[model samples]
Target: MMPAEDLDAEYPEDDWLSLSGIQHFSFCKRQWALIHVEQLWDENYLTAAGHIEHQRVDDYSESELRGDVLSIRGMRVFSRHLGITGICDVVEFHRSSRGISIQGREGLWEVFPIEYKHGTAKTIDADRLQLCAEAMCLEEMMVCSIPEAALFYHKTRRREVVELDDSLRDTVRADFQQMHQLLSRGSTPSAKPSKACDACSLRNLCLPELMNKKSVSNYIEMRLHEFVTDD
Candidate 1:
């Protein structure tokens, strides 16, 4: 694992990956590699809706202060240790005597990051990992400990609180480390298609079914055989 202080010298700015890609990497490594390393993307309804939601959250002009809480939307953050960067959907700083001091703010403020998702919560831990990654970055940046965070799902209109346990943090770190390794090799992992593939925006682009074929000729021959059998 790269230490926070040595990350600059080790990973450097050029090696930094997208912090948001943690969710993708967690869900499917091949998907993350395709998008991040190969620079490929395809937008379906899911991705399109996510973009719309992200736009609203990224409206930097939408910040508000209510009571003792200051909510900043689309705040940019990065983790040197993890070699990742991204924009937080919303980070609420609550007035707390034990929190870190923010410029132009009267008292110290405890940081709480909330990630907004277009769809409702799922059985997968991708969303939680992403939120935890954001919180980890905030912790490093603010020099304060954040024990928990929240995920707001648009579909269910639910705010799910996630505990930043040691296990989750360990996974987040290990995933990034593995990402950096894959990126250095410039190799994309094989596709592991499952039920999740049905909802993947890059289904067509990835062509998971054809990924395991030894060669294009073999794939063509296989397709021809299938066609002949159907006839």
Candidate 2:
């Protein structure tokens, strides 16, 4: 068995990373560095709407029991190994024999974490990655394995089940390690604009226009080469 200390990956409380930042990190490292590293922000309608949605879901004191399942809203969680802390939008505890016992609760209960999002399901794994990170936090705090979690999209009004596969878990771990290194160095990476930049809330503040601009000399040289080749 691994030593408890090594298993936990514990860090000083002050050094804990924000679990929500995982989504932004996965989407774009430069964007993550800008926000989390440099403390910069430029929110548009999309971000503001998402923020409102999150605020609505964050009823931390609320928990509902129905049948054999208990659902908790805005449950705070943390992981010692990942050195991250976050809140799950909703975590359902289902009664089961192969689960852990909860304080003041009867019988064993399995955990199911759910993350709420503003838009429809994304083609990228940004949201899924964040959900996986949240599961890691819950697993560490509860001392159990959360084999699966879910993403609930407000726009679609549907739930997408996510398997906590080895690949995703590994990525989550690796991403956090990279994030820590970047943060420790106080380095924000240079921007590389892409199609995703179209939807990024930080597009204006990130100055992708300047970064993407081609030099006049280079443009003229290329045009001359094209003209000569044609002749």
True lDDT of residue 96, candidate 1: 93
RMSD of each: 5.1, 4.9
**Model 1 bad stretches (over 4 Å):** 1-10, 211-231
Reference-based TM-score of each model: 0.88, 0.88
Q: Model 1, 1-231: lDDT tens per residue?
A: 445664454358888999999999988999999999899998999899999989988888999999999999999999887788999999999999989999888999999999999878879889999999999889888889999999999989989999999889988988898899899999899898798999999999889987565788887999999999999
Error of 2 at 226 (Å): 21
TM-score of structure candidate 1: 0.88
Model 2 misplaced stretches (Cα beyond 4 Å): 1-8, 214-231
